[model samples]
Target: MSDVETPETAEKEELLTEAEKKALIALRRDEAAALRRWWQRLTLTPHELEKLTKQRSLPRGVRAVLRRCDSAEAAMLTQGFRELWAMLPESTKQTDYRDEQLQVWSCIALVAAELRKEESGVSLAKRLGQQKEQTGKPLMSELRFQQLLSCRTPEEFIQRLRRALALADKKGVSVVLLASVIALWWREHRGRLSAKPTQRLGFVLANDYFAATSGYSHRKD
Candidate 1:
């Protein structure tokens, strides 16, 4: 039994890593053109650009993909990415690009743009909640959102994420996944203020997209 358990665990871990790698590879292949264009347009340092393209910085779509990323985390990242996409200048849009793929790449660019903004560890989760309220989007209750937002650091962030995942169950709003979403949100949005990086509205909009497709639910705080 012990031997079986060890191998099973290892296999599961391996599968998880593979899933993550596949997601990143897909983003890179599909978004390569946009990534490069954004890199040049944004004047990103090579290192900065690398972080922006990191899988953790992109959106999570589909069930299999979300499982690999932790659903709650993915949700938070989606919110941030969604907000950025909505704020980007019209020049970034390409008529030839597939709509879904274009939105994904736009998130990547938005992350880089956010990182380029003024560096301050703001309450990103809170900001998302606020944006949701302002936009009149159906979000997880404000109380729950605030509870999640109370997480200040990455470690605390993950803990809250786990809770959100548990409450969300497997339906699509897993707490850890939401945490990833928030991290991805932060990854893309934390930066200097001078660049006027697009607002968090894109991430917010993305959340709307997911709510419609994924059956996501939220209540007031």
Candidate 2:
């Protein structure tokens, strides 16, 4: 049998000083680009856009609010609608949201709520129940749209992310995957921010911090 590259073997491969296997932890510019673009097609089919892109306009009031702020995260929340809609149970798609923003944000919220499950070891239902208690109903409620829209300021945004990660189940979200999304999002909106040296996010800090002490284990040089 071939030795498939599970996380165990992959980490072992990273410890080896080989040029070809560096992509397991490449964390470089091109590698970061590869990571982010991977999410544009979470379902990975070209023919399904009709179902994904059919909704042309959000309700009038909802459109006005989303137009004001321009952040990479927001754009991802918007473009990610396709992936979100596809992943949902077909039975739930019939849910009648109270307003257009509520409908749109539902897709985004499902993704955000993922953070709560991915970052922790709790069960999915319990975490969601706690969230529901705060609103005095379930997450499916259109009024709970505020839970998703609460990220108006930096503090609230951080809390929203923190809550999702802190509360969700152990197998919840993929860290490497989210890292890739942010990596791509930054590239699209980087022009608005001040220029700086090239950067990589998510998994690089430890690799970078250990370079000197651990003898540059990930580099071929």
- State how far residue 188 of model 1 sits from its true place (Å): 6.0
Regions more than 4 Å wrong, model 1:
1-140, 173-183, 186-221
The lDDT of each candidate is 0.35, 0.32
Lowest-sum lDDT 10-residue window in model 1: 1-10
Tally clashes: model 2: 8
Measured by lDDT, the strongest candidate is 1
Write model 1 residue lDDT over 103-182, tens digit each, in one string. 34433333333222221122233233332334454334556665653444544554554453343331222111222344
lDDT of 2 at 14: 39
For model 2, residues 43-62, the per-residue Cα lDDT tens digits are 22345422433222222333
Worst 10 residues of 2 by lDDT: 32-41
What root-mean-square deviation over C-alphas does model 1 reach? 18.0
Scored against the true structure, residue 99 in model 1 reaches a CA lDDT of 57
